[model samples]
Target chain A: MTSLLNALPGAVSQGLIWGIMAIGVYITFRVLDIADLTVDGSLATGGATCIMLIRAGLNPWVALLIAFAVGMIAGFVTGILHTKCGIPAILAGILTQLSLYSINLRIMESKANQPVSVDKYPLLVSSRHVGGFTLKNPIFLMIIIAIVLITVLYWFFGTEKGCSIRATGANSNMARAQGINTNSNKILGLMLSNGLVAVSGALLAQYQGSADVNMGRGAIVIGLAAVIIGEVIFGKIFKQFWLTLLAVVIGAVIYYVVLQLVLMMGLNTNDLKMLTAVIVAIFLAIPFWKNKIAGKRLGKKEASKDA
Target chain B: MLELINVNKTFNVGTANEKKALDNLSLTLNDEDFVTVIGGNGAGKSTMLNAIAGTFRIDSGSIILDGMNITSLPEHKRAAFLGRVFQDPQMGTAPSMMIEENMALAARRGQRRGLSWGISEAERTQYYELLKSFDLGLEDRMTTKVGILSGGQRQALTLLMATIKKPKFLLLDEHTAALDPKTAAKVLALSEEIVTREKLTTLMITHNMKDAIRYGNRLVMMDEGRIVLDISGEAKKKLTVAELLAKFSEASGHDETSDKMLLS
Candidate 1:
């Protein structure tokens, strides 16, 4: 138990990395009204791209940006498949997900499950500056990345373009009535959303010192879990952009904290999947519970009067 | 303010289910002409409006709005000069968004949308005043999500949003048909107020016969895919619902009871 407490920072740091992907998920699911299954494959796309580039001796920061660009192109293809070809959005996303598997493998060009050695990676694994304390690397990196990404996102959503994108999700015909090209907005929102997801994957690859082709399995679910939990908990406090992002970050932390606690309480590691499903179910059930409980109270009152 | 010259729109052209939605239709609205349109099911009243609004590609037509050749423009491209309200209350405003946010979006319609905080203090004040004008006290509920409002309130908010910048032309497709009677009256009244205040060129399609005559400086009646009767000025002022129905029978040679027009 004490050992798990000491390692709390590490679990939380990983959670922060996943939170970036969660926010990217929020953009598509909430903002664009698209259920993009592409994240599962595109995440590995980012991981593979970053690791391959870093292995080729590119700087991590530069490789990160390149990975983001690659994610954008991937998103653009999905958008085209949906828009130009008239495929249902979910199907288009699936097709992209399917295609990206081989593309990720091609990018890595390595046999599956080959972990990059932390000893040989070119970038700093732990972020420690002279003025600050040493935190397990991803936490510090996420703090910086989250700050920048959230700030930019906060500012962007308030803009005319961002509002239009949101409006596209709310009622697409209304957007068209107001001269908003909703099709373009949809494409733009997806590109941005997927790009962010990919950045997280890039960071994840570096943090774990490895890239796996199937690492992104159930990624959308995790992102959705973080988003729904954050919305339920802090949606009231963070009614708008920046605060909502902070809430997402907090939700990720809470998610990690709960997982760590579960572990400390002697839950088996093999049960993580079931635990994730259970935790998400609990959060998702809040609205139904409120209605059911309220209805029961009303029924009890009515019965007492009738008696 | 808007002109349609020999516009022809055919659905499923050259196919087994081919139905002519509009057939070489020609119509004109003079400056600030408030036109109300009525027709039975599939009578091309909505089709003419959609053609003008660029909802679909007409087979052949020249659509001129305020003297611009807009026959080839797509819907969003044409939306810069057009404000529209749909039959469904859900079509006009974002329910999850605040009334002010919806208004802000309408206010910026047709402009170059960008990644900057576009709403300013002056804009907020202007939006508040606009909401106040609705007289529903929505100005106080500027921050409220539109979903919580009654359908009437949302429809009124939509009306305000459509007219905020006063586009060159307005298209309303049975904008109040979906609301409860009381709420519909309130929204209809609001629609009348805004349309008259702006003296804007307008095309309104309505299922209610009384409302068809209650507003607008002009009235157009359609049969099949063509306008069979159009009245304006003194003629429109003197006409009643019964007389309008009789005129429709005289033109189309079918009793008013034969079609859905009289049923509404």
Candidate 2:
């Protein structure tokens, strides 16, 4: 119990960082109605770009910006493959992700892992300050970043171009009939989504003091977990767009906290992936099960009325 | 003005199930023509409208609209000059979007979309007044999602969306075929009101013989991917369902009319 309590701050900080990645997933999965698997590789791309740039004597902030741009390029490639080449969205994402594995390796100079020591480099946030009382605390920085991101997203979604993207997701036929270029809108959405995921990855690398090529493994599952957990808990309360995004962030925090508890209870780290998969599967099936039960009740009512 | 010259389309070409949907079909619509098209199943009525709308590229044709050659224009590009309503009520509007938002989308059909707010305060007031005029009480629920609306309400909203920007051409592909009798009648009346008021050059496809004879200044009949009968002016106004059937039979060399056509 003491160990778990002591780990809370680090867990929360990690959760907030991952929460940013979850927001990226939400844009593609919920808003764009696409299951984009590119995050698994794009996340690493962001971390690799940021770390490589920082090591090359660039400002950390500038590195983050460059990382975001590179992530967008990765997303653009996937978009072209899907929209221009007529590949299925899921397949397109997978192809980009598969290729990015080699690209990330090349970015790291064939290294499996690269360390960005906090003592040597000026990182924006770090786990070393997780329990710090000052503004340098990772939690504080992540909270501020989350707030800014949510505000910007809220404003953007109300714009004409944003509404067109939403319309494209809702009904492509109607969008085309209304003179919206659905293909371009989709490409824009994918780019925006991957850009955010990369930003999250950059932050994660800085916080952990290292960028491992495997850091983003199963990232899509984690992102989906965060999005689903947020919806399940705050779906009713967070009807507003900004609030919904906040829920996703909070969901990540809760996910990490719960994961900390599980680890403290003596669970093997290797089994964590299986546990996450089961939990996500159950949550995904919940709506279908609820509908089936409701349908059965309606059938019984109809039978009674006929009698 | 709209013109389709020597348009042709074939589905599943080279396969055993190959079918020619449009075959060297040609059509010309003068300014404010308001032509209604009728034909039996598999007759190229909807295909002709779709070809004009650029839903799919015609195998070979030259489409001229408003003095511009648009044969190679994409669907979204062509949509700038066209307003289309589908037979399925669900196909015409984004079900998850708010009523006002849907209208806002249609209002900027041909314009470049940017970072500006999607629905302006002034536009909201205008939309409110327009919705109030529909008598469907939609003004009170502008923020409601279109998904929860009844089929009739959706059709009405779709009609408003189609003409919200005063499109150069309005294409109705049996838009009211899915509605109930009373709602269908109401939508038909609304269509007439909007068309006459806007003076929109229009092509409307219908399965009902009565509706084909009743509405529009011009009437056209198609069979086997070809326009077999064309009537206009006083002749079209005086035409009856029986006369239409006789002409259809005579033109197509078929003694029997499909039950679906006759019953409707």
- TM-score, B chain alone, candidates in order: 0.94, 0.97
| Candidate closest to the true structure, highest TM-score | 2
DockQ of 2: 0.87
Would candidate 1 be rated incorrect, acceptable, medium or high by CAPRI criteria?
Answer: medium
Candidate 2: residue pairs that collide: none
Name the lDDT value of residue A66 in candidate 2.
93
By TM-score, how accurate is candidate 1? 0.90
* Candidate 1 lDDT, A135-203, residue by residue in tens: 545567678878899999988988888889889998888888888998888888888878988988888
The C-alpha stretches of model 2 lying farther than 4 A from their native spots are A299-307, B255-263
**Could you report the DockQ of all the candidates, in the order they appear?**
0.73, 0.87
lDDT of 2 by residue, A121-232 (tens): 8999999998778988999989999999999998898899999998998889999999999999999999999999999999999999888898889999999999999999
Candidates' interface RMSDs, in order? 0.9, 0.5
Question: What would the per-residue lDDT of candidate 2 be over residues B1-264, giving only the tens digit for each residue?
Answer: 788888889989999998898888888899999999987788888888888878898899799987899999999988898999999999989988899999999999988999999999999999999999989889999999999999999989999999999999999999999999999999999999999999998899988888998899999999889888899999999998888888888888876556344426
